[model samples]
Target: MSKFRKKGKKSQPAVNTAALPDIVFMLLFFFMVTTVMRETSLKVVNKIPSATEVAKLEKKSLVSYIYIGKPIAALEDAFGSAPRIQLNDAFASKEDILLFVENEKLDRSEQERNKITWSLKVDKNTKMGIVTDVKQELRKADALKLNYSSKATDNIAN
Candidate 1:
């Protein structure tokens, strides 16, 4: 009925930004609470194997540490000196590692032995051949559940 329709009006869509910040905060809190920290007595850098499928060991008592380095360096590091590997120190060679693991497997209570796990930490500059040789030594000792990890977060290889 008017000479012309009222000038059309456009509505600006409403955007809800309030919930976004809350959601972001919730996610951050969840991750912070759920994160795990690995505990270890000694520190060394190692390059561990990666597998899409793997199993975790339940018992900590059966675990043992293996250190590999140039024969001289390994010996020196095991004993009194800088960069000491004294997480239950007293190992100098493959023989010593094997002996210690064997003793641990035997000394543990029957219940503890059933859930044993072994872990190794070695220097990055160490040779693969030496690493393989050490693995073989561990195998001979009947240390079946072996695990390896880097000493420092920064040293973890891609």
Candidate 2:
């Protein structure tokens, strides 16, 4: 036999997966850190109207949402079918907006406070009266930078 001949039938070595678990855990932690979960459970009937001119918000981090609509079926018995304003997770009166605005402002840095945009998510059939009230509250809060939340539509006239 030649000196350099292969030994019998040497079995191929198995893959060294020593770092596999570390890589898997690293990716898991990365996803856990980067993934954004829903923050609030909506309690209103939020059927936002559509508009042809709807523009996608560029910086969602600087936007705060104000939900306006009648209570959902689950809450109608308690809150009635009248239009209600939802700030975060709870129902709020028009007067509460000022405090809410202040709180939102406080959450951001001084430079970003003025840049924050308040987005009004109003239902299609919702009367203008409540919307007017919300606007008045925002005005009192000096939250003048407002945006109406609406989805993209091909035509509004239809």
Candidate 3:
């Protein structure tokens, strides 16, 4: 009787982790299929001024971009130098800008005009005089919605 009872089989966990790799692979595949792609490709390079509180803009808003500095010179002259603002460009002149804005606003119905939003995406190196002039021009146009950006990026905030 002692010899028969002398040894007993040791208990061990029967569950094996051999299937863990397959389970992980399946879960990864499921997530990969369900993931959604987001928009990309808007790259702005400029020093963004700091703000105390940031406000989010609604998805539905009209944004007009303005590059204050000069346009890039010819390819030969474009060796790591800041480009000048091309006044020939739209919004380059205060009058042209105001006219363009007024025209665009006129095209919209009164209801739309009431909700019209004007955003200024000026470059960081923009001259104070130019920015002030632009502001004055916008005011002359009676544009109520004004959003001026000091950053070089695509962020448009109040």
Candidate 4:
């Protein structure tokens, strides 16, 4: 027999996968820390009206949402069926907007205050009168930058 005769079929070395679990855990933790979830839970039902021309907000930090809709079933027993304005998580009247805007501005850096845009997420079925009142209040508050949040429409006529 030759000196290099078959050494009983030499077995292949296995790959060391001890670091795989650590790598997977690191990736999971990275996504968990980096992802941003919605901060506010909406109390009102919002069926946004569709629009042909819809622009996405660039800086979400510079935008504050004003939800205008009829109160949910639970809140209806307390607030009635009238369209209400939701500032943050609470129901607010037109008069509350001034103070709300001022307070919101105070929370931001002075340089960013001017760039703040108020996004109105008004329900499709809500009355124009309520919307007009909200607009008037925004004007008085000098929070002139306004954005009407609406769903995107493929139809040009919409």
Query: Which is the leading candidate under TM-score?
Result: 4
Q: Write the per-residue lDDT of candidate 3 for residues 1-158, one digit (tens) a residue.
A: 86655555545668999999999999999999978563322222333354444454563435444345433344224433443222223224566767767776777767777566666555565567866776787778777676655434355464
Return the candidate ranking by TM-score, descending: 4, 2, 3, 1
Candidates' lDDT values, in order?
A: 0.59, 0.92, 0.55, 0.91
Pick the winner on TM-score between candidates 2 and 3: 2
Q: What digit string (tens of lDDT, one per residue) describes model 1 on residues 14-73? A: 897889999999999999997755554333443444544445645555666665533343
All-Cα superposition RMSD per candidate: 9.0, 4.5, 9.0, 4.1
Model 2 lDDT-worst window of ten: 2-11
Which window of 10 residues has the lowest lDDT sum in candidate 4? Answer: 1-10
Q: Name the runs in model 3 displaced over 4 angstroms.
A: 1-52, 73-91, 150-158
Evaluated against the true structure, the overall lDDT of model 4 is 0.91
Question: Candidate 2 — number of clashing residue pairs?
Answer: 0
Among residues 3 or more apart in sequence or in different chains, the pairs in candidate 4 whose N, CA or C atoms overlap within 3 Å are none
Where model 1 places Cα greater than 4 Å from the true spot, the runs are: 1-58, 70-87, 151-158
Per residue, candidate 2 scores C-alpha lDDT tens digits across 17-133 of 999999999999999999888887889898988888878789978999999999999999999999999999999999899999999999999999999999999988899999999
Model 3 compared with the native: what TM-score? 0.51
What tens-digit string does per-residue lDDT give for candidate 4 at 1-158? Answer: 55446654666689999999999999999999989898777878799988888998999899999999999888899889999999997999899999999999998999999999999999989989999999999999889999999888898573
The lDDT, on a scale of 0 to 1, for candidate 2 is 0.92
**TM-score versus the correct structure, for each prediction:** 0.48, 0.81, 0.51, 0.83
